[model samples]
Target: MGGDFGPRVTVPAAIDALRRHPSLRILLVGRQEQIDPLLSHCTSIELDRLAVVHADSVVAMDEKPALALRRRKDSSMYLALQAVADGRAHACVSAGNTGALMVLGRGILQTLPGIDRPAITSAVPTVNGHCYMLDLGANVDCTASHLLQFAIMGSVMVRAVENIDRPRVGLLNIGAEEIKGNEQVRLASRLLAEQKQLNYVGFVEGDGVFSGRADLVVCDGFVGNIALKSSEGLARLISRKLRRSFGLNLYRRLLALLARPVLQELQAQLDPGRRNGASLLGLQGIVVKSHGGANRSCFGYALDQAVSEAQMNVPERISEQLELDLQSRDGSVKTF
Candidate 1:
């Protein structure tokens, strides 16, 4: 109900996911009138695995998080999160107001033990498969401790979801040197390096993120958000420039025709839709945030991400890892 296309996109995407995963069950939390019309498009088999829990109101895309939490208690986003908090669903996926989702998710699900706040994490395509980056905009300002927490959680997430036994973690910094970056980053790097459990690979510059220098990159939300958005904008700019270049002349047109398959493969590899879901890690329950403007296929990818995380038991894994780390330290380390 909160995405750009609302039920028109989500309903179909949910059905598509159900078809892909036969054991998957979906509880569509939205107004019946709006959701029922879309249900007609689903097959009988698809309908059997789907259920609609009526939520008469919706939190608008631009709505303030505080207002959504205070006034929109009956909203689809609220109920969907409540379902996860209530254990009725393993995870909640929403292409809704991101701020609202973060606020509501933290309020409902609560943070895992030793975690002060949840970080928004997502897989960024790299020269080598992909790398997970965290604090994508959950907390604009963070202390060194927060960054350390993100590194620990991100390492656990990548290891569980990507099947890396000892995922390498890096601090996103302006330069590779220990003398570079702000005081917060320098402190975070020192803290990360001290952790024997993590494969702390020191600082990784902006370009190193896609270079696959590390399996997980950690930073404060302000820096992480800027980096993520800048990469997205650059991807779009490059794609547009390539399309224009291919259409400039007859020779170029012919060249483009000859290179069509290769270009298509490259585009598919770089497509943001293929990596649409960003997990709100550190929370006790699973919540995946999709791009608000995502189409049905993109939304389906977000649903797939949710399913994957749920299957991996990511939150539990993180909690257990933290507990083990704390015990190993003889409870001297701070929980934040």
Candidate 2:
């Protein structure tokens, strides 16, 4: 992993991962000194299954992806991906520089054929249950056709991971009516509405995200990213307010005793770990992204999500469904 804190942060997360997923084999890629002690922490970790590839380069959170990727040949993120491309590992994941990671991932792993552009997508928890939002921060500026493809990809993803049958898709816009928003959203709405393979639920306002109306929400990366961060911030703010309320006064404290169950449930509802782990969906291999600020529990959840995606063969399923659905419409590529 190309981590900012190197071994100090990764080692503990690694130990927790091993406890949670004994089947998880790690290729620890960092400065040897930084990673060696981490391996030592886990006495139960099978030394044979674990390996290290030394990489001295680390990408800063704000570095230019293209420049860093071009210059940093020995970066840990680069090596982790190389391991996948070389068939040394089945998948690669990083919680480092997201921008750099995206650049290196596409450069090394390449996009799936017929995909307009690989999107950095993640499933977020909805009030009803769970749904996915795509291009969370990958492509901020997207075309009408790109949004259509995102809707298709997001639908396939919800199917593979969440087992949703005929997932309802919504185009993110200023208003619920099809007449609202920019030309891109308007045009994308048309394409999505016409897609016989998709369950297009029509234009959804931003408020509908938490309203649990759509199983898949598609939008330009900038808006989606803003939504993700804003939601996370709101969850935190709400949690703090509840905690403050619980600790306020004598009668309030007595009331808080009665409200404990409700508070706990609300807390769990807002916790990021309970929500779906962020995923780099369009990559060649399954890449589950944890929050950069993830705790050991969150990292563990991400590891579980990765294992589940790998077992489900989500990437292949997505590719298969996409080819069949797109080809069926074009009538060029035969699909079974």
Candidate 3:
């Protein structure tokens, strides 16, 4: 109901996800008229695990977050979030308006203790597997304290989801040198270095993001968003160029056939759809934001993320870690 394709894509993806995970159940919140046609294709067993919760409205893609929050009370996006907030669902996943999702998610679920705001976080494929990065576009402007908070949450997320021990965290900057970044970044770097619980690896440049110098890279939303979009554009450009080059002549076409397997592997690594879901970290409840333009396969990947995060109990883990860190700072446990 929220995405470009609405139930056409989401329903099939949900059914596919349900088939893959035997214990998984889904509460599809959207207009019943639009959703029923799609669910009609599901088998009786699949239907047993899926339930539809009708939502009469939907947030427009271009709608302002504040406006959507104020007006769209019965929207699919809002109701999906409400399901999570009301304890009817373990997590919420949407390929809808990102801004509205963030606004409503915060308004309803609230942030975890010690967290002032939720950050948009995601995993990017790197030379060494992948790296967890945040704030992808949540807070455009951030203070030193905010950046420090991002690092803590990101470190906890990577360790919980990826099973990395003492995940190395790096602050994104113009240069790797300690004195190279802006005052806010430098301040965040200092704060991060002082945290013994974190494996703070200092500053990393744009190139270092893919080089896997750190398991987690933290930045304000402005820079993080630009970097993410630029990387996606570049990956597409490279893939297109390769296809054109390979199809230029008969000899090249023959070469492409021989190299098909290797090229397929490379394409899989660079496909944005493979890592389709971005976690809205710092919120008390789990909410995964899928790419609005994602297709059925891509949407399935996002559902996979929601399932994994729910199973890992990421928010609770992060809250526990934050509490421990706060307690270590003083002899007494500080309330957040």
User: Which runs in model 3 stand beyond 4 Å of their true positions?
Assistant: 331-336
lDDT by residue for model 3 (201-248), tens: 999999899999999999999999999899889888888899999999
Candidate 2, number of clashes: 0
Model 2 C-alpha RMSD vs. true structure (Å) is 3.2
Clashing pairs in 3: none
The per-model lDDT (C-alpha) reads: 0.92, 0.77, 0.91
Best by TM-score: 1
Give all TM-scores, in the order shown.
Answer: 0.96, 0.88, 0.94
Model 1: worst 10 consecutive residues (lDDT sum): 327-336
In order, what is each prediction's RMSD in angstroms? 1.5, 3.2, 2.0
lDDT by residue (2-29, candidate 1, tens digit) is 6789989999999999999989999999
Question: Of the candidates numbered 1 and 3, which has the greater lDDT value?
Answer: 1
Q: For each predicted model, how many residue pairs clash, with residues at least 3 apart or on different chains?
A: 0, 0, 0
Off by over 4 Å in 2: 1-6, 43-45, 243-261, 331-336
Per-residue lDDT for 1-336 in model 2, tens only?
544444666667766666667687877777787788667746654665578899987777788999877987788888888887787877776778888888888888887766757787776778777777888989989998889778877787787777778999988889987678999999988878877889999987878887888998999999999988998888788878977977889999999999888978877876766653677777777666666766655666766677777767777877887787766678543211
